[model samples]
Target: MSSLRLVPGTPDAVLSALTAVLDGRGTPFAPVPADPAAAARVRQAAAPDEPLEHDCAVVLTTSGSSGEPKGVLLSRDALIASATATHDRLGGPGQWLLPMKPYFVGGLQILTRSVVAGLAPVVAGDSFTEAARRLTGPRRYTAMVPTQLARYLDTDLDALRSFDAIIIGGAATPAPLKARSAEAGVTAIPAYGMTETGSGCVYAGEPLDGTSVALDDGRILIKGTTLFSGYRLRPELTAEVLRDGWFRTQDRGEFMDGRLRVIGRVDDVVISGGVNVTLPTVQARLLEHPRVKDAVVLGVPDTEWGTRVVAFVIGDPGRDELRDHVAETLPRTWAPRAVIRLDALPMLASGKIDRQRLLEELR
Candidate 1:
């Protein structure tokens, strides 16, 4: 049986312990924040008293945006497969700039890839720009979510262009953001995948080596050696997703020019006035508007409409004007019924919009 070790969630500790695990020199580890409440939850989920499956090499906690924490079980073989495939797809591994925390799969993969390439990753300093300037490599790569990418574009275009490639994932990439990234001399590759698939198996709408993507009723299904073993102690949930080695992702996707294009989460759709509205579709339109900087489209409870479309915007834009912008291309019902202006949207540690927090705001 494998043993479990709990450590502080700080990047340094997490990376040191992760290196030991990946090198097969120590027990599987789980990261817990220093906060009492968060640490308690992580401790309970880690189940220190229970022995893990022999093949399990790491126990990663999910963001748990919807509910309780879940520990994802990933094996060393799977991690090696992912590292190999990533290097093969990227033309070879050189050096990686680590800008994200190691608790998540993406950050963990960065560390793992560096180890596989026999090079140490350059952890970003206090500022992303400063850390980027410190990097030295013939081929350097890094990953960022949409929010971080936007911040870099606005604040440090030089830092963004310093890397050979920057991968964006964790949420949908707006069309405007992609275009802006390209215009700024950034080789930004929009990736698609999740923790269960062991990070991004698809880069820039193409599957990496050893990764296969298929569409099931518009939902994305992934088959690859990088897939996780299962959810810790959640056999039923694992059974629901992993069927015959193909993991059923909850995100909807489509094929354009023989490349996979992720639409949005399956549950992101809402019925407003008895008409279905895809939040991504509405959000893409909102992003096209010049006045709107960043926006999130969500559904709120409504009596007249099954669910009312609401938009939270970062910039100063009139509700009517943004609504009309969306209506110009989409159906009138798809336009946001209400808009809330915020100085900045609540973000998770991984730089994703905290959708559950936004729902609580409505409540």
Candidate 2:
């Protein structure tokens, strides 16, 4: 038996040990005692009976921006299934590099796939130059958020080309970014899904192999082996999201050309002047503008309408020009009634746009 250190009752310690054991590194954990006498006693006696047998595994905590964060259990089998589907879709698991942190599900998935594919993942330390150095060889695969991809596109087109495929997720990929990245031979695949679904189930607007998607009253629903068992210690919440073996994703989506296109959150849609406006769809169109770097659309209260469309933008462009641009693309009524410029958009710890904070700022 391989001797390994384990700290008794702490969740992080137990989780770390589980990751190590599942990675096939060692067994018969020897946990280092904590300084506190009471905690030390608990650690000395605490040992998980469940044996870790999968490839590499980690528990992901939900962002909990709307409520409390809940841990989702994931096994090696589920992770491998996700990776296998991705590899099958993308051809093969090439050399992997990650600019994202390893703690989140997206970051952890990259490492898990690297371990499963028997390739060491190159991790960037505080700089893209270090990550670019690791991409020196032939074709490589990496996962990045849209913001990171945009920065790379603005600065390092050559480094971006080194990637065989760049999986863009964690938020909607602006149309301009998608078009630019594809033109540069980056093979960017815009993905959609969450921690409960083991990262991404939809790639480039299509559901992955072994994944099924449906819309219940406009709410996106996913059914697959990759779905997590349930939220830890939140049976009521679990029951709310899961139904009939399908996970009812809070995102609202529509089917077009046999592909699922996520519009926005069901609750994010608002009625303005008796017309329903989907913020994400409007934001997508706003992002298509050449001068716009990032954009977010939200609903603000109004007496004339139940809610009025408001847009917050990061790029420096004339409000009239943006309004005209939206008029040309979307319905004039759907165009934002008010436009505000923001220096930067708030982001959650998971690298997703903080919708709650945006709403708060709007209020």
For TM-score, the strongest prediction is 1
Model 2 clash count equals 4
**TM-score, model 1 to reference:** 0.96
For 115-148, candidate 1 gives per-residue lDDT tens digits of 8887778888778888887677768889888888
**Number of the top-ranking candidate, with lDDT as the measure:** 1
Q: CA shift at 192, candidate 2, in angstroms?
A: 1.2
**What TM-score, over all chains together, does every model reach?**
0.96, 0.82
- The 0-to-1 C-alpha lDDT of every candidate, in the order given, reads 0.84, 0.73
lDDT of 2 by residue, 59-83 (tens): 4556565555555656556777888
RMSD of each: 1.5, 6.3
**What lDDT score goes with residue 42 in model 2?**
25
Tell me model 1's lDDT, rounded to 2 decimals. 0.84
